[model samples]
Target: MGSSRWIRPEIYPLFAATGVAVGICIAQLVRNITGNPEVRVTKENRAAGILENFDEGRKYRENPVRKFVRGRAPEIMPSINDFFSKPDL
Candidate 1:
């Protein structure tokens, strides 16, 4: 009687957590190099941008929940019909 499981059940969670940790580490490293918000906010040059980001986040967070949502997303919107139709512009 032999078991065919390549990965032991006891180690699965450990491996999964390790993988997640590694991925997060890699993501943070990339974000750091790419000037992510957290890293850039630490710099004096980014004061305005940091404030803008916070203001935007706050505005979004403070917005009241909508009873109903409308429209396709902007990119997907403005259909072929829109080409024939002129705006106020």
Candidate 2:
């Protein structure tokens, strides 16, 4: 059958390699079009010190809600290693 011929295991690696190559090419094309080539230094930016730049970058990186959640660790699942390490009574 036509379907069985197309489903051969030997063809899978060729398909995977072609998919990866196409994905990389598309990503590079997108980055070339949208990515900035150089940083622009305005009068305000030039006047700003390292601490001011750091604060500005921090504000841009995350909002208040994200900042608050970042401090706490997620406890979705207990660690298996820690569970096994405890001495049984």
Candidate with the greatest TM-score versus the true structure: 2
Indicate the residue-level lDDT of 75 in model 1.
49
What TM-score would each prediction reach against the true structure?
Answer: 0.33, 0.38
lDDT of 1 by residue, 15-84 (tens): 9999999999997688565644445534565564535477645544443333233444444456766777
The lDDT of each candidate is 0.61, 0.64
Off by over 4 Å in 2: 36-89
- Alpha carbon lDDT at 8, candidate 1: 73
> How well does model 2 score by local distance difference test?
0.64
List model 2 lDDT by residue over 1-89, tens digit each.
Answer: 78997789999999999999999999767654444222335657445544435554555456566888795667545477558767777
